[model samples]
Target: MKTILLHVSLVLCAVSSLQSRTWTEAQTGRKLEADFVKVQGDAVVVRAANGSTMQLPLARLSEADQTFVKEQAETATKPATTAAKTEEKSSGKEDAKKALIGTWDGYMADSDGSRHGDIRLVITEEKITASNPRGGQEMGAGTYKISGKRIDATGTEGQFRGKKYEGIFDLDSKTLKWCSANDNPNSSRPTQMQTNPQAGQFLMVLEKK
Candidate 1:
């Protein structure tokens, strides 16, 4: 627990800086100015000025960039760090799953902060049901999977049948924040909780009922 707390603290410190730096590609020498988010596997995640996050290959980065990532990764737990991180993620998934099994009241919002819809969601261990609370109309019913903070909801019935909604979730005891593909089933998963309806992304804010 101490190691985990230390690791989290170190990562928080690193990300808190949110400093933008020019990163150069090893071969192409192409440069991009972005803030370091975190290192994921063989790639480093960075946030562009526009708040979009992207991954760049560690090997493709200049030596200085590579060193920076390495230092961040090693600053926490050193021995078998990769395995430790994987275990941590798995544990988090289980905890999140438990926290999600409840009914929620919420509203979905468009990118421009317009009210898209009012939603009531019932989530169980095996399935999820979405409805329009004001109209008593069922909107969707689906089976959902949670992995770490990532969620995938595949519709098996109702209006959302045959569609898969991919999203990342932030959950606490009372509140849940979801950023997901909106309207377009084929759209990619959202990395942030902010809505961008033009980009086929929407944000849902819910409170446990």
Candidate 2:
């Protein structure tokens, strides 16, 4: 983390001061008085007083210089840290439950955009049920758990037995969506519904009734 900050500081300094300045690298017992040009990756870019560019490793910098880099990094990340906390508070499990513990209705479509059937969803305190008006197959009964903005369900019986589902709640927490292909045993949690002809569609969305 400190190393990244050191590089960022060097880049900022490069644009602010082109004049040669002295810096002592205590770790290497080296002294340099050069123009700060930029920093790229793990190296600081500088121009020697003789006008030749040089790349120096941040690990060789003095303890004080490294400290300064550390401070800059903490300052830059503070806002992001605060925003993350705010999001967490607003999207906690209790909050997600409020938006999800109810019934919903939607349609299931194939990757070819063909309508599969009209589906009814029933979400309870600890379980979810899906009723397919067309197939008459019981494939949507499962126990569920909610965390943050995610809903995870595991099958109770039938074809869906032992299968797991992972899905996201919309920002408004009104729409639930997940990949149809993710209902496999130990399969990776899907990012979107399958799109390839064999894989089918990208996702399924069910809205509140």
Best by TM-score: 1
> What TM-score goes with each of the models?
0.56, 0.46
Instruction: Estimate, for each residue in 104-166, the C-alpha lDDT of model 1 and write its tens digit.
Output: 998987776676789999999899999988898888799999877889888999888898888
Q: Model 2, 71-146: lDDT tens per residue?
A: 5445555776899998887667666666677877767656765665677678887787878745754566889876
TM-score of 1: 0.56
The lowest-lDDT stretch of 10 consecutive residues in candidate 2 is: 193-202
- Give the lowest summed-lDDT range of ten residues in model 1: 1-10
Clashing residue pairs in candidate 1, if any? none
- Model 2 clash pairs? 111-200, 193-201, 193-202, 193-203, 194-201
Q: Distance from true position, residue 151, model 1, in Å?
A: 0.7
**Which numbered prediction scores highest in lDDT against the true structure?**
1
